[model samples]
Target: MNQTVVSYLAQYEFFDSLLALFGGNQGLLTFVIFMIFCLAIVGMCATIGGLGTYAERKISADIQARIGPNRVGPYGILQFLADGVKMMTKEDVMPFSADKFLFYLAPMLALVGVFATLAVLPFSTGFTLSDMNVGIFYLIAISSLVGVSVFLGGYASNSKWSMLGGMRGASQIISYEIPVTISILAITLLAGGMGFGTISAHQRGLPTNWFIFHNPFSFIAFFVYFVGALAETNRAPFDLPEAESELVSGYHTEYTGMRFGFFALAEYIEVFVVCGVGAALFLGGSNLPVDLSFDIIPLQLVEVVIFMTKALLLYYVVIWIRWTFPRLRVDQLMSICWKYLTPIAIFNLVGCAIWVVLFNGKSVAQLLMGGGH
Candidate 1:
């Protein structure tokens, strides 16, 4: 009951703040504040993608004990900026046979679709842009635009390789989305709520209180979701769309200058978003093991840091996987999805249901206490 009230008041205050900003003479202030907030997030993304590009090479190179990107800047740190400027100054190319309107719009659409999903994501308790009752549903609905945007980019390219990449993206996202859904469903069942705040709050005690610990099935579901998420976002071992040797930049083959930059940035940011969502759903989110209520550091800062830590760590994992593993054949990729992930997800869902009926929180807790011999 106490938890219920806190959630209501937090959501009410958030809505009131937004409504008040637009309803009064503070409209201009609201607009500027909103723009700044969005710009901050964008700026952070740019920095991550830019610097992260260099970091990926450096880390991967160090593991192999070879020199990496040393000439571009100190430890090759400035390489990303150089790459940005180079991309910016490059001549824009549009194929004469391409659909010019869509060719130009595709990258922007992809970026928009990818970035827009961040709006509903809660960084920490009482700290999202807006905590809609249907936040999860909103995320799902908005994220599906990635598929449409990929299709548009591919179809507009007027190149067979580009079209093939787009189609592969379409199929890959669709296939992986199933296991992702199943994994997320596991969380919803355990938390008994859909809003991210509620889920985060439900695990307030220790890291062990995370939904990932609610049942054995949920723990497995988390890994299943993480794997599918890699596939869904077209990252690393799953990045067939941009197979450098085969497709020479794939769906955005004709994109140049800043247009290509946007596509590249979107892909990286999407990587961050998916991993962040995973952390929030299964890893106890912003609730640190310590008492958050008493933390001297701002809660928002801690939340963002914890959230980003999870995302970036996952990002590194993706890079490692990319460097270590060869791409699977298209047929093998589909078989892994249908034969392995999908069936396992279905079994996990059923297992969770049975676990809940036979031995939920109380029973499990008792067993841990050595009560039910």
Candidate 2:
């Protein structure tokens, strides 16, 4: 059975007391628990997204040798909050020629697509909202909504710049997704399953056990996936979709107030989600360095902390890369994805499969230690 947060909670004795408090309506109790968790996860991600903007500015400032936002609240920690309030209070302006329905729906789609992926993100063994057997596939499929939203937003605006930006975004995202998906498929092959839970489980115990270190091909696959993910999420040097120099903010040129805020927030949160997926897939996820014979709530929380640390470290890298690299030209972007990344990703996938067959699915570390499968 696919374990979920509620199911994991049900294994505890206190859950029985809560069941009685809810008059033994297990269905109702499950619904309430799921709702609470959903709220908590969404709230946490939203906060992370808001803080991402602050991080971006601060990191950029440090890179450029300047002081960033420091006036708001104690080293400008609350700058994101101030920005949020500003966005909320700003006048919402839509182009007179815009398609009313799509202009409104685009941001909603972006937010929904991003938030939906959180359901299967393996924060820990027991904390995932849903540990679906098709978790990885679900995330890949659902997150495409952001690309659709980008196109719709650009088209709905009735501006040449927006239309061009949207087209670039759609094509860039679609092209890059090929290598990303294939790279992930390689990990799925090594894990023998597409579920995030299964993938993470295969990599538990130590850093050497991580899929990235499973083989040379898997290690290469990690970089392939990272590059593809950066493009997919519109991060620099793959941020051609919203290049301010040429497209004047691109797909969101005409968007203002909270509508534009939604797009920004979606992009930031999607970065976090992508980084978390990378950490879970390539790092050891929430797994500790040492194996534990028993699981407890405290240990689970510790695992959550470990998982966050990995994800956030990757987050910092994403920000660092954005500030470090110059944006790629559209041709260079497409060339990298199709000419370079796709071919390399395909090679890695085939190599991983061959390695699995030749070595009886033993990771390099396992084989070195004379461990048998």
Candidate 3:
């Protein structure tokens, strides 16, 4: 059975009192708890999405030798709030010729797709909304909704530039998903399961225990995954879909006010999700550097902190890369996915399979320590 927040909490004595307070209806109590957690996670991610915009500008300004957004609040901390207010108050304009239904549906889909994946994200073992057995696969499948939203947004706009941008986004996202999925498949093989809990469990203890260092092939696969994920999320160098210089804001060219905000928020939140997944898969997740024997609420909070720290560091790297590198041409983007990342990812997957067989799934650290299987 999949563990959930409710189940995790049920183990605690305080939960019994809450259960009694709810008139002993487990189902109702579970539903209420799920709703609370759902709202909490969504609200937290929404805030992160808002801050992502702030971080992007501030970091870019630093790179370009300019001060950014310092007037809104302390160090411009409230800039995102200001931007949110501006977007909310701005007039939402749609093209006269736009397909109104799809134009309206597109932004909702983007936000829905991003928020859906939060259910399985391993924020901490106990805090995850749902620790689905097929967590990673579910995430990959559900998040593809963003691709659909992009295409629909572009097509519905009835603009030539939006159409071109949509095509680029759909094709780029679909193509890059191949290597990214395959690279994750390699890690799944190493960890012997598809669930985030299982994968993270196998990687507990120290940095050396992490799957990325399990073998050379896995190390290479990590980079392949990162590159492919960057493209999949339409980050710089792979942001052909939204190449403002060429396509004038790409698939979302016609969006305005809160509609535009939805697209932008989805993109930023997706980046965070991608970074969090990468951290969970390759960076030992929320595990402390040393293992602890007890499970406690405080320990779980620490795990959350550890997990967020790793994820945010990767987030910083993503922003840095966006500022440092020039965007790739459409042809170059396709070639990188098809000609290079795909082949390398396949090799890594095959190599991981063979390594598991020959070494009985022992990581490099295990072998180095003379711990024979």
Q: Sort the candidates on TM-score, descending order.
A: 3, 2, 1
Point out the worst 10-residue segment of candidate 1 by lDDT: 1-10
Q: Model 3 shows how many backbone clashes?
A: 0
Write model 3 residue lDDT over 28-134, tens digit each, in one string. Answer: 99999999999998999999999999999999999999999999989999999999999999999999999999999999999999999999999998998998889
Arrange candidates, best lDDT first. 3, 2, 1
Which of 1 and 3 is ahead in TM-score? Answer: 3
Using lDDT as the measure, name the better of candidate 1 and candidate 2. 2
Q: Rate the local accuracy (lDDT) of all candidates.
A: 0.77, 0.94, 0.94
What tens digits encode model 1's per-residue C-alpha lDDT throughout 145-207? 887778788899899989999999989988898988887877776777777777777777666
Residue 234 displacement in candidate 3 (angstroms):
0.6
Q: Which stretches of candidate 3 lie over 4 Å from their true place?
A: 371-373
lDDT of 2 by residue, 273-298 (tens): 99999999999888989988988999
TM-score quality measure for candidate 3:
0.99
Model 1 TM-score, all chains together:
0.88
True lDDT of residue 27, candidate 2: 96
